[model samples]
Target: MKKLTTLRTKVFAAVMLTIATVAATAQTNGSGRLVKQDRDLPGFTEIEAGSAFSIKVSQGDDIKVTVETDDNYLDKIETVVKGDRLHIASMGMKNPSAMRVYIRMPELKTLDISGAARIETDGGITGTTLEIIASGASKVKLDLNVELLNSKVSGASKAEFNGNASVHRSEISGAANLNALNLKTLTTNARVSGAGKASIFARDEITADLSGAGALSYYDNGQLNKISKPGTLTFTPQNPGSGPSEEISASVEATDAGDSTIVKIGDIKVSVREGNPTKITIGGSELEVDDNGNVNFKRKKQTRFDGHWGGFELGVNGYVNKDRQFDMPEGYEFLDLRMEKSVNVKLNFYEQNFNLISNKFGLTTGLGFEWNNYRFDNNVVLLKDGNDLINDNFLYARNYNKSKLVVNYLNLPLLLEYQTNRFSKKNSFHIGAGLQTGLRIGSHTKLVYQDDGRKKKDKDPGDYHINPFKYDLMVRVGWGKLNLHANYSLNTLFKNNRGPELYPFTIGIALVSW
Candidate 1:
């Protein structure tokens, strides 16, 4: 019996020892020999590269990294994390195998890429700023959601951005190309000693200073503010709607008649003496060109159609339910809606028009956000049961003076507009009739009153039986910047039979028209 007990104890000990050894192996070599090291770095803010290697970065909570390389080149890469910045570089240029580095971190404040390196992102990176300095035939590609970006390229390097950005500023020298897409604004100062090019697409505005034989191309809706010496600048306007087809081209040529230069663009021609570069004569108008190569057209009224406009509008809104179709629950009634206190606000991002014939009649469509508020005349409360909105009187409450229902929506408006003079700055009679569709974002009721001599407020957030989708018929008529607007909802305010069948209408004045 004693020998059998001793044998059992020995077997149990051996099993536990084997289990521990397997666990330790998994902790060290689970990802295989491709990953040399995996580590965590807290409070990392930026990344800087020193040499030509591939990198993939992604957004995460705490900074984490995995160094991936071939077995033969595992000892040829190094990663260092310092205060707010992480540095990745090659130990030496002797290794022929390329290294792949993967990084995960929180949103960074800056990303600096320099030297001969290839840096990419696993997904779109959001940050405040981005900087890239490439040399020695290196390449950098980024999918970014950044607010500010600055890039500088020298030697034979190239950089491209595939995501949206708010503002981008860049400088290029040597032979390279910088391509960016969906940029809101772009500013570039380029000097091409050899052969270089910069192309930007879907931009709102472009400001460039070009020198040497380099070229720049842009497709945008906004104006081009340029200072060019001897390079090519091609601009394609972003026209969404059908309009009069027009092509504009300009070129400068040296004339044999003295040291003057002749600038010919379509039917307009200007002659500039070399000694008097600022003075040019176009048609019968004498224009002054600024030192930055900006020509002002204020000397004559230049009438051109601007295809798109964006701005905001604020107005007061009031609803009318004359048919009294709104049905309340057994113990509740809707107080009179206050027309003076109700408000409507819209933020128009883009309004594009296509000319049907000339520019007098057009079709317009755009994207915007609409916020509507309807203030009730009495102190009332709202409750929601499932998808139904139920109204309850202030039975347990007292001294509430104001109660309002607010609804927010994302709206798309399609209209047919007509104007007497399409390209006039003066008063022009304009009228538009349209249909708008809205997707509900949120709905809430706000109540304000005095309780025991202290001001108090209550807010309730829910669907409130408001329709998830709404469509309305709208019309606008006015002169120039001022217009009277009206909207009538075709659908009931609530879901079928869930609440009142109120058809809402708004009459207000829009401050601006596009």
Candidate 2:
């Protein structure tokens, strides 16, 4: 009996040891392992996400919420269902990158995000009416097969949509970007304000209200009713024969042009040529007063259309190597630029236009001066020599606060321009494409650095292997007073075999124009 009790005690000790080891192993593994838990939540018709949590939603017969995250974070995340809305959020978690919530519901009528959370639908959202609201830097991409879609996006958020909807109503403000170009809609009512940008695909009808520096581009032929305030706005249609076919009535604003008084209403204009016997011109028809003061109606003669030039432009300059890539090739890293800081400014001070094809088309010649600043990403200075490679000619020293090369050019451009509505300056759509030739007026290198706790600036004038004369292919397109321009250099930036074969280009917006 003594041996039996001793053996039983030994067996109990071994079992207890094994159990403790297993418990410790599990605790160690659970600390770093991810845990997935499913919460049996009630059915919800709407969903809201906040606090930077990623959410994936799908449609199913029953509602289910499955959360996957670090084992310790499983309890910190919140999934609360109140009435018909399911709210998914994190309480105090600093890093929620690993947290993912998968939601399944029978129907989803609304999806709202009030934080920087990323929400995407696994499949198409099918319903009669669907509303999506996004704010606070959130990103939402959804596929919809709904009858009606109402979306309001603000802040720096972006919303992208695809699929088919009968009607889509969108209001976008701030710096938001709305890309619904693939979401085919029969009718769309859009309001874009601030610096927002929207690309939409509407088939039949579209009503657009625009303000601020916003731009709207639409695909497909849609009859438009547009209202625009006094601001820089761009309306571009992607498809041929798209945009407004009929003009809507608007308040009139009058401006004087020489001896003529031009009254503008929306995109339409009427000109009254004032003199002893006043004459009025409307749409190609003219009402004239003779010397005897007798009223007569006649067909109006073709008039001259003023070209759009003489504007102040601000843009960013970039370089593309011989491989047509923005990245510099090997041994050419010193030529890499701080592209965002490489500013390009232009002042077009003079313009001359010659009419062609009854004032609808013209040839425009303009004189402008361009100031191009190429800020180097590396701390290197350009040397003044036309005989050596850039790598062999530059000096690299201490880290400077600013290192840049400046080039000033006197530009002469010859453009063939066309206008859609020649009668109204505020309503016409104009596009110009032409060649620009430039002569280098000045070139210099500037460096700003600190020396012994004191800021010092140095400027050195140099040829720096830069091309004395350069040519570029330039294109300009705009609606009303808002215009955008791009230029691509045809020749290399530097003399052949002297520096890296870089092609310079610029893209920018016209700030002020006449």
Residue 303 miss distance in model 2 (angstroms): 2.4
TM-score of 2: 0.43
lDDT of each: 0.64, 0.77
The clash count for each model shown is 0, 0
Q: Candidate 2: global Cα-lDDT? A: 0.77
Error of 1 at 373 (Å): 0.8
Alpha-carbon runs more than 4 Å astray in model 2? 1-302, 384-386, 391-396
Off by over 4 Å in 1: 1-268, 271-309, 322-332, 385-388, 512-514
lDDT of 1 by residue, 212-253 (tens): 545565544433322335553434346332211233667988
- TM-score of each model, paired residue for residue: 0.45, 0.43
* Most accurate candidate by TM-score: 1
